[model samples]
Target: MLNIGVIGAGRMGLNHSRNLRQLDTIKLAGVYDILPEKATAYANEFGAKIYQSPEELINAKDIGLIIITSPTYCHIEALRIALDAHKPIFCEKPLCRTQEELDELIPLITNYDNFFALGFVRRYSPNFAKMKEVVDSGELGKLLCGEIRCLHGRYVRMHGDWFADYDKCGGVMLDMLAHHVDLQNHLIGEAESIYAQSFMLNQNEDELPFDYVSATARFKNGFISNIQCSWLRNAPSDTEMTICGDKASITFSDSKGLLLTKGGKTEKIPVDEAALNIHKIQGGMYAEEMAYIVDAVINGKKPLAGAKEAIDAMTFCFGMMTSAETGELVKF
Candidate 1:
């Protein structure tokens, strides 16, 4: 069995651990976390060892696979260890928390010789794939503009946790909006410039950071997208993206729906119908993403998305944050 060691025992790490445990071909070999108690709990529950450090986990002779599910800020160091270890590895998104970290990571990732994948699970959604197909096929004409809305239902839920700290999680921008930002950069085009505003950066010492952000981006291919994301105090969850072209437009949402409108008509494609049945064929996008990484690791194939794509997304995201900071258009 492929022995996999995971670094992190937080929310996302635990989520991935559950999924990893569900995979029959892999063994959940060990876990490492700064918090020994959390790591111990995971080790005890999952029948894995508590690796004292990332180096210990990565250096394990029997553990051939590494999965880095640590927080955004914690990713860089752990990833550097795994990348240099020459083991097939998977890392969760946003790449890193800051430009300094990005600068440190880029060369290593580019020069790395082994399998390296970044988790951008939205790519696995059939709706996303179909939308990409339609846009690439020119069925929507030349991609022109778009909007991405991600309302996270409510904001009061994570009051006293690490996620509430903007310095730690980057509020909603790095924590949540990165997914849609990557999607737009993927389906729309490479980001050329961005202007963004956020309530996150300015905070009193005693309070949590704000939970809203809006960013407008112009792509190299002349595609423009306005992205608004918020964790409203009390609102229903909603996330949708609409890309428009000269001839038509396409819209997709994970739980909402997939739609296409052209010449005053709208309907779901057969892919959407197939998407309705994806749960029967495989697990949801998360599981499918994990399975894809596992397959790539075992078979020596590249995942649907990898390091370069992640870096592109992270670069664009940083530009947005820069724009937010300066209150001016950031040219990339």
Candidate 2:
């Protein structure tokens, strides 16, 4: 069994723990969180040991894999520890809060030979994977412009939660939209330029750092892409994206399988959920991503998403943030 240690016991961390527990080839060996009670809670529920610090957990002899699901700012430290120990790692998305930090860490990461994967779960979703295959097969003809939209109800952060702070989470741009940004980069190409703007809708005493962002990017492949994300006080939660090519267009979501529009007709491409077997796990996308990294670690297989893509996505996200902050287009 591939023994794994987890850093952080929050929502995403707990979700990872539950998914790790479901995998037969992986064992939840230990967990550490800044809060002692949180670590204790996770350890008791998952039947793993509780370590006093991240240093101790990553250094544990039994932990062959380290899963870092801590806050965005905390990822660098945990990653450094895991890299130093030469342990394979799976870290949550938006690798870090800033471009400078990510750039500094990239060289250090290049020195390690161990496996490193990022949690861009959409790549693991069956519907999206099929869409990628169809797009890459030239079935859609030459790809053109695309649109990605994600919206969620008011994200009122806890009193001291870093997620509510722009310095820590980079707001919706990093915490939420980074997933689609990564997907766009994967499906389209590297972003060449970006223009964006944001709004802080919550004007109350308990204000959020950043709320809504609308941006457009031009890809190196000569395709234009638009993205809009929001965390309004009262709004519906939805995520959907569409890509249009010369001959056809593809669209996908959790609710909608995959749709292709071609020759003046729309068709739904059937996705074999049973064959994917991701439905067998109760933890949803988190479970699928966790299982993917576990398989990669044990079998010496390359993961669908890893550190390079994660860094690229973060680079795009930070560019968008810079554009919004300066009210000007950012060029790469």
Lowest-sum lDDT 10-residue window in model 1: 274-283
Candidate 2: stretches off by over 4 Å: 154-159, 200-210, 278-280
Candidate 2: worst-modelled 10 consecutive residues by lDDT: 200-209
Those runs of model 1 whose alpha carbons end farther than 4 Å from true positions after fitting are 157-160, 205-209, 272-283
TM-scores for every candidate against the unseen true structure: 0.93, 0.94
Give the alpha-carbon lDDT of every model: 0.81, 0.84
lDDT of 1 by residue, 1-332 (tens): 88989898887778777766777878988899899998998988899988888999999999988988887788888887888888888888878888888888888888789988888888888888888888889898888899999987666645556677677777777778878888887777678899999987335656544478898889898888889888766667789999998899999976657889888998866575555334343447787778767777888898877878888888888888778878999999
lDDT of 2 by residue, 1-332 (tens): 99989899998898888777887787888999999999889988988899998999999888999989899999988988888888898888878878888888788665659898888888877788888889899988999999998988756665356776677888888888989898888888888999998862333446544389899999988999989898776787778889999999999865666899999998999886754565366666667778778888999998888777887888899899889889999999
